[model samples]
Each structure stands twice: as C-alpha cells, then as structure tokens.
Target: MKFAPSVGVKFHEDGSVRRFPGNTFICHVDPSLDLINELAWAQEQLKAMKCGFKFSYLPIESMHMTVFEGVCDQIRLAEKWTSNLALDVPLSETTDYFAKAVSNLGAHQGFEMVYDYVHNCQIGGSAIRIKPANEETKQALAHCREELRKATGISMPDFDDYHFHITLSYRVIELEEHEKAELKATTDRIAERISQSFGILKHRAVEFCTFDDMFEFKPMLTLA
Candidate 1:
C-alpha cells in the first residue's frame, strides 16, 4: 500500500518465474472494446508462422483479465448458484473482501491499459502484455489486492511482481529454426502496429467468475 502500483509492484518481466496461486477467480474484460482487434493482428502473425507448427487462437468472445486469484470460501457460492438463480456470491473469502473493497473505492473509474508488447515466449505460448496507464486504473486493481490481503488475512503466493497480459494463442507444435525466425519477424510487425493503439475495451467491472467456461462464464458477482 505504500508504494505506487501501475501494473504490479512485484514487476516480473517476461520470461522470469513467479509463483502463481493454487486457484484463481478471474475478471472478465468487457466484450465491446476496440482493443480486441489488436489480437487479430497478433493472430495473423501466428498464421504466418503456422506453416510448420500448430496453434490455438482465442475467439474474440473469450478474452478476460484475472483481477486476483487465490483461496476463497464456497458456502456463499453454492448458495448463490442455487438460490439466487441469476446473481451470485463467490465462494472465495478473498472475493468477499474484494467486493466490499470495490464498494468503498469512493469513485467508479475504469483503467486505460496500454500495450507493453506482443510476445510469444510465455509458458502458454503467445500473449499481448499490458500495463495500466493511469493512477485510477492501477490503483483500482492494486487496491483490491491490498484489501483482500489486509482484510482476509490470506498470504499471496504470487509475491514477486506480476505482468498483465491477454493470451493470444498456445503453440501446440514445436517450431523449426526458419519458422522461429519468421514468427519473430511477424511479431515485430504486429507489435509496431499496436504500440500506439490503446485497447478499445474499457474495464466495466471487477467481476468474480468461474474458470474455464466458454465466453459467458458464470459470474458470481460483478462490481460496477
């Protein structure tokens, strides 16, 4: 809480190892943003390199950013999934504290996320890295993490700073030497095209959602 937070205080650069939570609850990106088209450019690069490799490209509808993921309780979630019918309360105790933290934020502000780079060196393959451009956007997510830690008494496992990114595709097959060079060239061009463009989508809410569901995953709670 003492230091400034734009992306994450732990600031792990690409290729560095950082501890990840054992479990995660994610925050979905609003579907109507213009920035998603940037993925199209990134995908095209994958296509160019697909000559000797296999890849998995994400559909436009499935993009989302994880707010915070870790341990939480399910007593309320089981109830929400059955009793509320439409609304939900997450099972995560951290989510409960985070939901309350968002309410006390005093103002509702969405963040502007700028491209850090489009790299294919991730554990999952390729991704578009992002950084929060303004204080509100940075603090909004940072504050939520702070609140969850302070209020819930849960220790964070991802202690080293983290980078924020959207998965572009996963490499299903290994690449040959020439193919790797070609892919790198493609990535360079795609990165240039998006360097100055901000994502069209604005974060609408801090949502609590179930993992691995198609586009419209079951949202346990949405704080707008």
Candidate 2:
C-alpha cells in the first residue's frame, strides 16, 4: 500500500458531515489479470459510443480495496505523516512503485489517483445485501439498514436485498430507447463472461481503511 495526503468532506451514517485531512491506499488480493482485459474491452465499447464527455478509464491493476480520509493542518505535514507508516506490499512491486510516485506529487494531485482506484473498482456500485445469520454480521447489517432508512426516509423491504455493483462507465445520463437496448445487449454479453470467470475463482475480502491529514491509516496505524 502507498499513501498520500488529502482534504475532503466526509459524510457519515449519522447524518453529520465533517472536514478532515486524509490519505488513501489501495489493497488487492490476487486480482485476476483477465479482469483488466475485460475492462479494456469495456473501454473500447465506451469509446465507440462517444457519449460526448471526457471519458477516462482507470488502469485495472491499480484498483483499491479501501479509502482513508481525515483532516491535516497542511498537505506537507500529511505527506510526512504517511511516509512514516508501514505497508504490506502487494505481489506486484510495479503497483507499489506507482503508488510512491503518485504520493510525491502532493495532496491535491493525489486525489486523481485515488479517484482512478475507486472508479476502476466500481466501488460506488456496491449495494447493501443481507448477511448470513451471525450475531456480529447481523448487527452490522441491521445498523447499515437503519442508516439507509434514515438517509432515504423510506422503509425498504428486507426481502429486496441484493448485491451491489459499481458503475464502470457513465456516458449519457439519459439514453434514447435504441441506445438503452444497445447498452443492455453489450453489457449482458460482457457480464456473462465476467460472471463465469469470477465463478471459477475464490473470493477475497476487501478491507475498509481511513486516513486523516495526519497522513496515517487509522485502522492500520501505518502510512498505507
């Protein structure tokens, strides 16, 4: 993991917003190389659509499993803070080197790298789903459901739970009938292949970590 300093507003489940100094790091486990190839194919499909906006795709290998945020008095201090933390380097040293290179650029510039990690991983698409019955898991899930109810002001049915997925591309906010049909067809073909690939592989856990301007990951007590 590599870390960088940042400043941003964080929205918590409690309905309060706070400003913080923070850093973000990427954690992945034996990510399938085929996934990168699939993303490239998706990017090509997106490019041909020419949805009329700057459509940038994140590199597949740089996906992040967690994002940390908190407040720092200044960017340099934050960077210095993160530099002192230890990291569990992934099997790919190239990714670690890239993380180091990006970190040296300072806080504001680092957000783009963070964005790339989140964007490529489709973290935003994750949806809430019911966990198997276990006291700890059940309690956590219940709390999350309560937060959603409060945030949306709607009492959603429990049976409606489903897996969450992140959006890979956003070309047109609203699409014409033909465009929607084309998109559906293309996505279905892509999804079929991805589903098969994932089905054959063992799943790994994704961790959540946060950092503050102090340039340290709160959970790991290290830079990355």
Candidate 3:
C-alpha cells in the first residue's frame, strides 16, 4: 500500500496532529446538542469504514465552521496574515489584538445553514459542506466575513470563492481508486441521512479562538 506524501504534510504516519498554531473566528457546533449528536454519529460511521484508508477524526467538541481565518505560523504571506503585525507575533498576542479590533463589530442574530454535501479535500481531508439556508442568511454570513476582513486587516486568498464547511477528519494515507469508490458510497449515505434528519444547522454566536493544533480550538472570546 502506497501512502500519499501529502498526508505527512500535516500529520505523522501514526496519525498525530502536527503543530500548526493560529487563531480564527468560528461558529462552534458544540452548543447545540442535536447538531453535536448528529455530527458525532456521522463521524463514528466514517471511522467505522473498513476500507484500507487511514484518517484522524477530530474531537467532537472541536467541531466548528470558521467565520474568518486569522493569522497562522505556517502561512506568513501578506494576503493571508494581518498587516502591521509581525509575522512572528505570538498567536496569543494576535488573538488579543484581533479581539479588541473587532470588539465593536456587534453580534450575529444567528443564521440557518443548510447541508450541501460531503467534500473530500484534495489535500487529504474530509469535510461536511454547508451553505446559508436563505438569502438573509447568505447576506449575513458574507457581511460578517467582509466586516472581519476590514476590521482585522487580513485579506483572504479565497475571498471570492470561500465555501463554508465543517471539517470531519484528515486522511493519513492515500486511497486507491477502489477505496475512493467505497469511501464515497459511505459518505453519500451519511450525507443523505444527515440532510433529511437535520438539514439546518442553527449557528448562534461567532467566536474568536486560538489553536495550537488541528484537534483543539481554544475559545478566547465570543463575538456574539
């Protein structure tokens, strides 16, 4: 079995998370029990796949949809990082600085996110795709992101083509053609069940969080 070289970019062969520190604004999935339970169930099913692929499932408590990405140690480009702050600024300091900079941005009145599909990222990960449920929700989400970009002074690379998603896991090994077929079949079933049962994910507050790795996001402050 040949492993994908890209898998080693973010994780060890044993599936341990590499150190990738950063901060961001996210809508956490933990506050809603129904949402959490549904996601946890889907995650378990993905873990149970017998196909010969290896991936690391993140802690359910850490599940979230990022509202606006913040500075990261790994990505030091001007387009992705905030201007006026050194690229080597401590993650904690950047988190603090952003908290105050956008403190007056006001709270989101909550929005409904409709299930889209399950996405298999080419870079070796799987995520549940989602979108705003209506035009109001759509505008709200976009406005928030735009406001954050202006307030934080960080221009996103994919600003125009950003897609909302809640990540499930990072693949640890490459999947063969046959394995991809099997994985897609299982994920399709899971996505169908989730869309039917819990189609709309009600996102309440936006949060500013710092993270030392992919598995955990430490909430520093709530934007809403």
Best lDDT goes to which candidate? Answer: 3
TM-score of each: 0.64, 0.36, 0.92
Which scores better on lDDT, 2 or 3? 3
How would you encode candidate 1's per-residue C-alpha lDDT over 3-54 as one tens digit per residue? 1121121112321222322224355566556666666666766766654235
Assess candidate 3 and give its TM-score to the true structure. Answer: 0.92
- The lDDT per prediction is 0.54, 0.33, 0.82
Model 3, range 70-173, lDDT digits (tens) per residue? 88877778788898588877767778889899899999658788888889887767888899999999999889999998889898889878999999888888
**Which of 1 and 2 is ahead in TM-score?**
1
Higher-scoring candidate on TM-score, 2 or 3 = 3
By lDDT, the candidates rank as 3, 1, 2
Over 4 Å off, model 2: 1-32, 50-58, 62-162, 171-173, 201-205, 210-224
lDDT score at residue 183, model 1, on the 0-100 scale? 75
Off by over 4 Å in 3: 1-9
* Candidate 1 stretches greater than 4 Å from native: 1-25, 51-53, 71-109, 150-156, 199-201, 213-216
Using alpha carbons, what is the TM-score of model 2?
0.36
Model 1 lowest lDDT segment of ten: 1-10
Whole-structure CA lDDT of model 2: 0.33
